[model samples]
Target: MMGGSAYENVGKKWDLGVEEQEWFHGLLPRVEAERLLIEDGDFLIDDDNSILEMVNQYCLSGRPWLDNSDIVLKNPIFREKWLLQNDDIILDRKLGKGYFGDVNKGIYKPMGNAVAVKTCKETFTQEQTKTLLTEGRILKQYAHPNIVRLIGIAAQRQPVLIVMEFVEGGDLLNHLKKQQKPFTSQQLIKMCDDIASGMAYLESKNCVHKELAARNCLVGNGLVVKVSDFGLSRDKVVHTMSDKNKPIPWKWSAPEVLLNGK
Candidate 1:
């Protein structure tokens, strides 16, 4: 898509901030961590910037992550469980996520049961806000079991709140791991079936998840899987980029979207 490119791993060597270091290690392999070789503290985000610009154009987007792939995970966005009152049970408080509140898995107190919470952290941007609102409204319109459900939105202060059905089983990536407990080839095929079914539903509704990837597909307690992470998705027209376009998680993107260095 226009304004987006495969991300570069310019400064993957820097230490993740004290706040973000833990989660950073959990998601990455040590070999992947060691390959990082850039220093990105000098990058910045400017207005009129595209998603790729917000990330790749500046070091913040690429910092601490090595050997850039299309899956651009930077800027831990979720910091704590303060979004809820004392009764909340946070399943996960993600960190260093970009442009949106650090996403989390937990239960809203007043509203019982497991649900996903996307807090609108400082990273929340106009572009991301647009994506969040659009995705939420779209998700609400459908009642499909294949897609994650949006029960309600907290939409309070800064980190806007989005309440969704908490997917029990980990993402497809985790399920793919664990040699002693890995899914069988048949199970993998079934996962593909569930994902396809969800995508067909999304397509029928004219939704476009521009950043689709294995992780974006949410898997339930060993039973269901659905597409997620709405920020890179679109509900409107998308086009080409300028000649100097920067990239985002490159491995996740199509090659043409990347601009050759001018």
Candidate 2:
């Protein structure tokens, strides 16, 4: 058996001391640990009995032989993206409104860039608040050109805001309907390709976009399409239905999903 300070906690409970540290991410998968190590020298301890560190161009682990068989880290995780000050966001006109809250076209002062600021309703329940924040947490893990990027969240005050990239052309469904000229075959193909690419990335991350539809996607400049609105997205590869009363877009759902509610 491999023995020493390295293999001591293989099957035992995770060390309490390790759990108390902010860098300690208990029981995280190899892919996830690498995702978090975005910057050079960035490191985190996981329950795999190893310390995974990013070294500019290589992902080296304390026990390389045990878990360095696949994948490489490039983009570093930014934890500061989670919390934001209310003062940094300047809310403008409303872009859209939904059941949970309003998404305003705002300016995030730090970056001085246009952003879609999503705010939850004041009457939100505890469960509703959790779901709103959960969406932010899920979106943080995703980084792709075909996927809408999350800027940050301003949750320091009453109206918690979720700041995201403001796609110029707006929602795909609306964009398609409002087009003065019909999209050419090439344009249509490009849009489909963009959506497929984003979905493929989500699949690789073992995530399911429960509500994948034109309405949930956004059109950016140059007619580029990006998958957006991940409030209904799940992290699991296979999700079984449990909430029978939950509302879903029946028209956009797959046959299997419509029949089995999965």
Candidate 3:
């Protein structure tokens, strides 16, 4: 690992040969450097300013480094802080089920609080595991009232678990369906406004909620709505869905997204 002493010489311009530049690039955090290389083949190690510019552009673009196998292998600092022991969580009952796995109501021992634990399926592959970790990282960065908060992740367990704040009222769609009376216009407007505000925050962060609907939103106390289900979400200034084989939510998708495949 590159030490603090190495970074101290960052401003100094040295005559770096092709071999030396390649070696220096290899010393960087694999995921970050590799992602930038994927976007632009040039490493831009000619000068400190060029390297800074490349990183700045990457951050401005808001493209998430979701597939960082090396980072995963290294067990990054964030992972160490967020990873929970298997014994720390006690599952209570099933809350809901999805394509990837089931979510359950649980109690986190460390905090002595109720939490919603979403676990991966037993038959998950390496890609699925990486995606789960990516979601955890995304949630960790976002701190808004209208967005569901992620407590931590149980990475060492058999079925990797995602611990999130337990929204007592449950999903907005189910809450609406179960209600005997329809919501008043004012109440309906408030809910819509809440969702819009959440999306606005996400947009500001250069993130896109590809799947935004009542079903994916959660209702908290006082009927406050918070957006959830980020499995299909992307943190990019301009995201194009290249996987044509995957099914799209046609009803919720825009015309451009459907036609242009974005």
Candidate 4:
């Protein structure tokens, strides 16, 4: 509620810009705001108008929000439980090759759980590594039965790895292509239902999957389908496309995305 000429003068005295003064709670001191942001996701606008996410201790601006709490409330942020120790993971065999590097089947020793490990190749471009990390961050905040879960990420050393829940059936595209017999109507309906459920969950959290296709969905035991790849996902409901040159899956994309590039 800090606005108007009087507060603007105070903001100037504090060396805060005009934009900062718009949302700046000038009357609230840092100590009091810190005291208020005690719970997880608890935040306050500082005198600088930057959002102080106390639990994560990050100053964010422009469309920043707390993680999806509807799925799992008060859980540890990305750097906490989501950062895995490299020694705890033991890679078994190569599952497939991915965009940045190889995907391997592995065991997470701590929980004795089978996991899918995605590594960043040494020769990867900066954009590739960033996409991998970005996917990890997006996946870490979600929890749904029809969405693949992110176990954690091992990024302390080279060949950064993304560990995820392992699904035995693999990608839906290959499964569909390999099917010897056509699926029954009920089975096809179930698969579509599962995909819808996962996408619904993401929508509830205000996330948009920029690229969703059969190749990005995984089939689990009992023919359960789960939404997987999130390299192009965005947390915002509306995404602004800055690069029209970036390639998109023309065949799989919606007409609006193909026409508007967003």
lDDT of each model, Cα atoms only? 0.52, 0.70, 0.68, 0.69
lDDT of 2 by residue, 1-262 (tens): 2223222233333353443333444433354566666654355554434433232114323333336453433232332545566677899999999656998999989888899989988788756765676677678888999999998765544556788999999999999999999999999999999999998998898777777889999999998999998776666543466689988887766455677666
Clashing pairs in 3: none
Scanning candidate 4 in windows of ten residues, the lowest lDDT window is 70-79
- Runs off by more than 4 Å, candidate 3: 1-80, 237-242, 254-256, 259-262
Can you rank all candidates by lDDT, best first? Answer: 2, 4, 3, 1
Candidate 4 lDDT, tens digit per residue, 1-262? 2123222232222243322223333323344356554564433343333432331222222123446432212211122466666667899999998777889999999899899999889887656665677678678889999999999887655577899999999999999999999999999999999999999999898777777899999999999999998766766644456677888887766555667666
On TM-score, the candidate that comes out on top is: 3
Give the least accurate 10-residue stretch of model 3, judged by summed lDDT: 70-79
Better of 1 and 3 by lDDT: 3
Q: Clash pairs of candidate 4?
A: none
Task: Give candidate 1 misplaced runs (Cα > 4 Å).
Answer: 1-98, 123-131, 237-262
Q: Which stretches of candidate 4 lie over 4 Å from their true place?
A: 1-79, 125-127, 237-242, 254-256
CA lDDT for candidate 1: 0.52
Q: Estimate each model's TM-score.
A: 0.54, 0.67, 0.68, 0.66
Which candidate model has the greater TM-score, 2 or 3? 3
**Alpha-carbon deviation at 89 in model 2, angstroms:** 0.8
Per residue, candidate 3 scores C-alpha lDDT tens digits across 19-82 of 2232132112245345544322233232223454334334334333256522211111112345
